[model samples]
Target: MSQSPEKKPRLDDPCINLNLEMNRKAHYTDSFENPSLIVRRGFPINITTTAPIDGVKLVYIAGTKHPQRDSQRLFGWKLETKSSETNNYQLTPPSNCAVGRWTIKFTIDAKEVEMQATILFNPFCKDDQVYMECPEEQEEYILSDTGLVFIANSWRIKPQGCGWVFGQFESRVLECCLALLERSPLTPTSKSSATLVSRSMTALVNAQDDNGVIEGDWSGDYSGGTDPSEWTGSVDILLQYLETEKPVKYGQCWVFSGVLVTVLRALGIPCRSVTNIRSAHDTENNLVIDIFHDRHGNRLESDDSVWNFHLWNEMWTKRPDLPDGCDGWQALDATPQEMSDGCFQAGPASLNAIKSGAVYLPYDARFIFAEVNADRVYWREDSDGNYRIKKIDKKHVGRMVVTKAIGCNDVDDITDQYKHKEGSEEERYQTRLAVTFGTEPDIYENVEDEDEVKMKFHCEEDYIIIGQPIEYTVKLILKDMERATALFNATASVYGYNGKFICNVQSHKCELLLPEQKVFKGRIESSEYESVVRSGSIIKISVMYDLKEATDMGFLEEEIPLRAPPPKVEILSQEPYIVGVPIQLKFSFKNRFSSALTGGYFRLDAPGFSSRDRLEIDQKLLEPGIECSYRVEYKPRKKGKINLVVSFNSDQHKGLHTYKHINVQNSKSDDF
Candidate 1:
């Protein structure tokens, strides 16, 4: 028998390979090494085959149910040969194409080849609905993964930055993100629209109505799950959810916002976390937060609440589903605060609509409008079992709106972007317009203030740090100098970050004769709130004044947030770090409190430099005024700019997180 020669591969062979490496770079997704080609729409993608073909067509199919040809979720495009190359061709997805993972099929010479790729909303393309003209904004909102979340009480303190690692490009994150879309209640056709997908995600991020990612728990009980404050990033939470196929145990507003940002950025949607200080939760949707108080000036339970600070996500997208000029940043909240359209989701509400008081627009615009512009009405119960409005604060809700600045770690005040200047004529006009569209259009129709006494609560210091006495002043201005006698009462209570009352710290009652202008100074000893401050609670002081001569009452309250001194972080290793080399870091903090500190621990997390599991160091007790130091060693795995985040938690304090940027160089050197 003679040995037969092996047949060479032919141009029309069944085995065909498509080259997408060049397309990845052009699409600006070369940084991510995904199994499928990740691309943004409206950009040309060059495809080269192993052999020349007679004919070619690309088919894209999204979702598994009721797929129709040329539909929004299912479409195909024919490619033209590029220049004179036989095996090279070019294809461009329309700017309005569906955004998600798509199954692509190439039919060449009557042979079908199957592959997968993910298409994202393109902000760089001028014709894309989600187009953002500013290049700086596109880089910050769409590409930046790590960011700062502002957490503070705007009433008495300035906003502070908390480092968050989104880790959108981490291994398996894109797969997990696509899985979330599959688990949503959206129909296959609805999933094709970016606005609908964002709306569905608000419900999918929390485990309230659906078995989604994070379960919200604000009861201060972490017996079975991790605490929300201890979470360093979204990578662990997402991976845990994918692995167990169950909702993670506990999370808060910031956690929900953080995870949603990761999912959106991974899917190529531009998103950022926003913090609204003194955010209102309007249950009745009348744009009024009604707080009830007893005759003794003690706060009673109510359906409405004003959180110390609330965090939500803002996604940049076009709003063809809405009116014109509503195509900028859209607010989307996933904290599961309230239900919308029979589910626990909120927004895709246009920020422009919110600012312009177009609360009648689609997709829960009124609810979001109230969140940033509601009026706080205090109702006091009288002897006849009737409630009377004691005071109304117009500037209480939405005191400050902020987010992370572009290309920096600074806080960007976006208050004007959401609403006009407070107390301005334009602001009042917009408020009136929004109120007219509310469910209770006549809420402020007959309400009037007839009382003559006015009360104002002021904090003596710019900010109150933990382990220090809190000092404040209450000034009462009596118009007409009527020489009135009044009963003054001050009560301080510890309130959680979720605006839930924990326990009363102290109370003081006094009888005073009001002068033309009277000022009362008060102090809350550090010992009174030391035990409760460890739970990350703020001190809410309620001041009540009853005027005997005028038979009227006045109430004033202020929330004081105690700032924690951050621990100093130092990189002991020299600069010019190379890949695969170990680096040393040192963290030190002093116990400034009068009492000893116990149950102290430090958590270190670096997305690319460290493992999926965070590094934790536990410590023993440290006496007062004692300085504690810790040293950690981390080795770089890749070369780039990496962020090293360190957080300290103890029985005396919690959530003291900070980050440092480390630039790692490549180990290999090339000669010029």
Candidate 2:
């Protein structure tokens, strides 16, 4: 028993003892939640603790989804007092600290206390009262990847899939951007960041021509017959612009806004897209969007139009050259709708100043202001040929302006951030004050008798499945006791999520006599639209009725839902694939259709796979009664259950998918 020397303990043994010290647990005398405010750079941030704790070190970490590389030491400091606990610590972040959501951690004794906060690039050090009045997510939303967005001219805000915003930056995109930089007159020699922004905007839209980069084509028919969804990512669009200096065919306001967001983000500027519902375009600089109607009360299109939804961008920056109140969150519109300073670009207009009715600020502030705060006037000529207002809608111009929430996929109601609540005393006051401050006196003086045309409008269905007819009924319930004539115009228009119109599937126009209640019915047959339209199309229904004494108008819009495309092939694979071993796949398909399909291809995508592009078929055409099979192999790079997706598409058939889950086990053998 006294015996042999005890075997030396293994280094990996859990019971092996060594020099170590136990850390103390963090215990606070008082508890409090983190503040919901932005931490300005180059400013001292003060944090207070319940107990007086000394020997404490504070570390600030940047927020990132990746846990491994998440902790970035922005600022570090130690307590200076001799007491066991230091009640307060003031930490100052460097001037170049990143502007984003950040976490602050305190190593008290050996334990840790953590809190979350936001960092902003406000150089002027605006007071908390001002920043708080703006909006919480204004800075965060613009800086983060996720954006709360509005689409299809709808007021409801929802999360939109913007994966393209974060797509891998291609070399060609960078090259094109760099080429623009070379051609730009802006350099370090320029003092204002606005100059760099202006130059970048000029290069992005090629500011010389209104249709330089993306042709503002509402008629659609884009380049390569590509739809807005097919445009893929910003890199693809930018490269297309560089390779061929022609305007990409289809770009609406949202497309222009999206592209501008991508370019601004790429250029290291914090930007976000904001949608103004019932946005007005006052072409006359009259501070109002004019609506003209014929003597019969039929609505007529005018130079000044109101887009159901208009999108523009807001960039975070300090404007040193502008007036006192004009700084932070400058608006920029690259849609090329109007000219600014002899160019088609608009804004870098200050949102702060925009709020206070500083329409006198430079860079088309008057036009931008009119978008959200313009008057909507319906005018008609009397028998005497003098134009008079049929009705006036002040609250309809800007409603429910929204943005994306920070760190979440939800809508951020920034309507208050843009303007006051509709019809509120403050709203009326701001409107009147703004007009008095800058707008002409005659714009608001022409208020006339309200046209008492009361109508209730709705759609039977909100969405439509692709390759199907769109059936909807517009019911008009006239509350006024008057005989009226209703003019109905309904069109099934295919558009991108960015509001780029692809084509008009079908258009219908009819005249109806309005009684107490009348149902205006319409249908878009599948056969009529199957070839011309795809998913993401909208049925825009407009009804204009003129009463003998007065006239009014009504409108309704419906979104079409697209069903998943039919499967083109069947995939055969075995379960439990061996890691480091090849898994063979067989895709069997038959083409029995009358037409031949050229550009027939199959694509396989999965995690840890090295496939770059879709595999091309040896023979392009698949004639009628042709049976074809494709064989491919993939070796699992990791061991686990992997979702492998196989897709097949042709010039005729698009977006066919087949997916399977395959269990992969690690292998001991190097070669198999």
Candidate 3:
């Protein structure tokens, strides 16, 4: 008997289906866990070639976070191949591939799809744990005695790269050796632990597997003992330098040393393949020096070979760590060591590296670069196993497995490479910037205070680069100049994001600088005058400047701190107990002095005051007279009155409550 039709299921079930955010992430897969030294998978990558070639190395390329535009740390290729066929997933790198943390990238064409994996031997970070924004300006660079990092360029700033690309360009790499002196010149930080860095250097030298070698030749290698100092000469020796300090742009060209650096990075080592392609004929080296202004020549205007010949990078291996605390690989490898010490101990021929006779020519070949002769060094140990870097010769040097693609000369194909992108010329007309005013929403900010206005204007990121020195003449107007003058001595800053040419204006009505290069002398100023009063400022003002990179949103931003913790509670009344009697509860409260509270929340919880059937329920806010009242009515099912408690929470206030004890009574009993 189908008992009168069973109730139909409700179509609307309240189940929340999650919509997760999928991203293109880079990671290394671990094969082992417990002992944690195994790697299992690596994302396959291929060059942007159509009919992929044979023996061409392709490595993971990560973007940089440097505000200067080029956000690249891991520059150059990641893998090397000499095979004469199509490169694919079938092509596996050596098992002992270089170790350490790296963001693995996936590429099929110009666009990239990314993923990530953590190898115990070289574990990848689990989260955006790489916090801490890097310095936005050269001035922000700090030489701290922190635990691991020594001299850091971008300190204290943590750039959050929200999308798939990591924010490392805005992150700091610790220089352990330099950090040694930070702890009062005695206690060293992780980066400064000379012993640990030296130990890793030993590991790197020892980890030199014969299979890792990719044979190649150095053009300047000698049969017997050779002198790198004699070949490259001391960088200190400036024979012909137009500029004594700033670097002279070298044009497109590739030497054998540049090839070596690229090969190393492919094998999972951090290396640079610099192209010091000279544009002018120096007649000294019988070759042209790579000059920026010139197509392909060296200048006798300033006979400087160090600045002319090649660009170099500081590379780190899985085993042999660098003396400095250089993590993974970096393009921002600039350090006081290399900059001050002058050159690499290991000459190109003596580096014991795999060589590749290759040349990569970018349009701006002057800026393009790779490794150099002095970049490599060796670990020397005596009877006691103490290690020091001993110079090595060419024979022991490793090889760069030159891919057959080396035979191809596709270097001159013109491609539009611009700062904001091509055909986007129009996009350049409009500039984007992050204008900072208050650290947080200064809803209570006193615009009247010149210091506050000065702080707001000064707080702008790279203000001068965008507007500085009152180019053509705009002004940062103070809304009520007379009124603002009464409270604030306002100042402003114009930056170029690099902090260079960062000008600070101590005046409220200073001239504005041109915001862009097109009109270096174009007039600019504070978009609007700041009002004397923040509450009534009809003017939502901004300082106009030329922005290097366009911002999606206009400047004049601020963040608000968490609202002050709110007020609290007090208890009032409850119902008397009985089976069928109506229950009542009351509470007492007054506005606590903190953030303004519009309303309050009351929580009514009962464990055993159950009514088989639904009981009547009522809750309401009472009007304010002398004492405000909260009233509620419910029927009691059992003998006793339940303990009713209330809590209040709001955006402006929190942590408030009180309790009302309801004593149930029998309606008919004489025990009133």
TM-score of 3: 0.18
| TM-score of candidate 1 relative to the true fold | 0.91
lDDT of 3 at 265: 20
Per-residue alpha-carbon lDDT of model 2 for 1-672, expressed as tens digits? 533223222322222111111100011100111213334444555555555433323333321322223243334322343333645555554444443445554443433455444443332334321132234443343233223334434554342322223221234443444344334444322312533454356435533463356766545344454444333235455667789866665666666776676555544456677777667787877777777776654556678766666778877665666877666677778877777666677887877777767777766777888888887877776778777776667866776676655554446677776677778787776677666644454556666654344444555544544445667666665566556666666666655433344567666677667674477666777656555443233444445554444445544445543332333433355555677778777765555444566787766655444223567677678885576667887776655444455555666654344455456677644232
Error of 1 at 321 (Å): 1.3
Candidate with top TM-score is 1
* lDDT agreement with native, every candidate: 0.77, 0.54, 0.22
Displacement of residue 502 (Cα, Å) in model 1 is 1.3
The Cα RMSD in angstroms, rounded to one decimal, for candidate 1 relative to the true structure is: 4.5
**What range of 10 consecutive residues in model 3 has the weakest lDDT sum?**
143-152
List, in order, the clash count of every candidate structure.
Answer: 0, 9, 97
Using lDDT as the measure, the top candidate is 1
